[model samples]
Target: MPVDQPHSSAPDILHGWGARQRGGRIRVKGGGQVSQIYAIRQAIAKGIVAFYQKYVDEQSKNEIKDILLTYDRTLLVADPRRCEPKKFGGPGARARFQKSYR
Candidate 1:
């Protein structure tokens, strides 16, 4: 299911391993790293996606952006759970959604 971006403007990357689940909804839990984000996208584009959540500091926001652009696999879409509040958070802060796995 990979997007096969050879003809498109897709980035070069792919998804990774299993999710490390969490417990009762914490307030600021994250899933993957910036790299992992793209990894998830690649998974979806490739159609074998497993997701990771990332809880980054203000300093890392740019890194996350890099991940979004440099890798076609990392996308703004795909992982809706990751996009929502209980996980990825907002401009001022992030909220935890209680890890879905463990």
Candidate 2:
């Protein structure tokens, strides 16, 4: 379950590993740069759960399974250099263009 940085992502991955016993609620809370994206996604998922709960939806469990499956796997497997915006030919590395003075 290692993401971008092994050292930074270690604690979050460990937290998720033992969450299955607690009704599969993965609690990833911290103040780290690498964990922000994951924490945001978890918060969003919790909101979705609340929505389903109000509606008495039975498909929520399956949806949670899909989310867990996606989180558990390495969704991004591209080389770091290949991910630069310039590689896609839209603009420069920062996706910015030089101002034309014409």
lDDT of each: 0.40, 0.46
- Model 1's alpha-carbon lDDT is 0.40
Can you write out model 2's per-residue Cα lDDT over 67-101, one digit (the tens) per residue?
Answer: 54466432222123434435443366666555679
TM agreement with the true structure for every prediction? 0.23, 0.31
Stretches of candidate 1 exceeding 4 Å from the true structure: 1-55, 77-102
Clash pairs, candidate 2, are none
Q: What is the Cα-based TM-score of model 1? A: 0.23
How far residue 85's Cα lies from its native spot in candidate 2, in Å, is 42
Candidate 2 vs. true structure, TM-score? 0.31
Candidate 2, residue 84: lDDT: 47
